[model samples]
Target: MKSVLAHPISQEMDSVAFEDVIVTFTWEERPLQGPSWRNPHKDVIQQILRNLSYIENQWRDQHIENQYKKILSDI
Candidate 1:
């Protein structure tokens, strides 16, 4: 008997000017006690990166709008 598990981690950064952002993705490998166990860490990491990119874009758009609103309000 064996167990299979994979852990994926991701991070996103927003630019100070609210014009750009970056995303980082990584994974952690655990002990695999089964012969049939396959490491899907890479695929998981790729998917996480894709999702993070999408989220980052959305965040940048919202941030820009918010900044514009703030500037208008201040004026």
Candidate 2:
């Protein structure tokens, strides 16, 4: 399959502000206790935001290709 990072939508993601990204992530009703058995906590969500910050830094540095490579490799 083609890489999502290479998609046109990713270009729009690159333009979005960091604050907007955080707002988007936190806006939804994320249940503390899930439909699944595991209970998720605020810190888990916060950690995701932290990881996103790292990716955002790379995106801001215009290392788009390298970002894709890193993401794909992680998967």
Candidate 3:
């Protein structure tokens, strides 16, 4: 629902809605290489949408951990 990006070097973060994230996704099956457990052409966007909640949670956890470490280092 908020900024889903988490990077140590980025000082400014961009905010985006969950719906916006879903709406703005664009991809191509072509020009893709390597192997996978499933077909790469089958609804890649939908699969990512399904897993977005888990991905968001991981980002939130990582962001919190980073903030905590920053505070500890500042002390």
- Output the number of the lDDT-best candidate: 3
> What's the count of clashing pairs in each model shown?
0, 0, 0
Q: For residues 1-75, could you state the per-residue lDDT of candidate 1 as single tens digits?
A: 896558544466544842444343344343433334434655766998999999999999999999999999999
Runs with alpha carbons beyond 4 Å of true place in candidate 1: 1-39
- After superposition, the stretches of candidate 2 with alpha carbons farther than 4 Å from their true spots are 1-40, 63-75
What RMSD does model 1 have?
A: 12.7
Candidate 2 lDDT tens digits, 1-75 = 875655455434345765775533343555543756333556677888999999999787778777888999999
Record all residue pairs in model 3 with backbone atoms less than 3 Å apart, i.e. clashing. Answer: none
**After aligning candidate 1 to the native by TM-score, how far in Å is the CA of 67 from where it should be?**
0.5
Task: Compose the digit string of candidate 3's lDDT tens values, residues 1-75.
Answer: 677557566778788877875533235643363356235635786787779988999999999999999999999
lDDT of each: 0.70, 0.68, 0.72
Worst lDDT window (10 residues) for model 3? Answer: 22-31
For residue 7, model 3's alpha carbon misses the true position, in angstroms, by: 36
Best by TM-score: 1
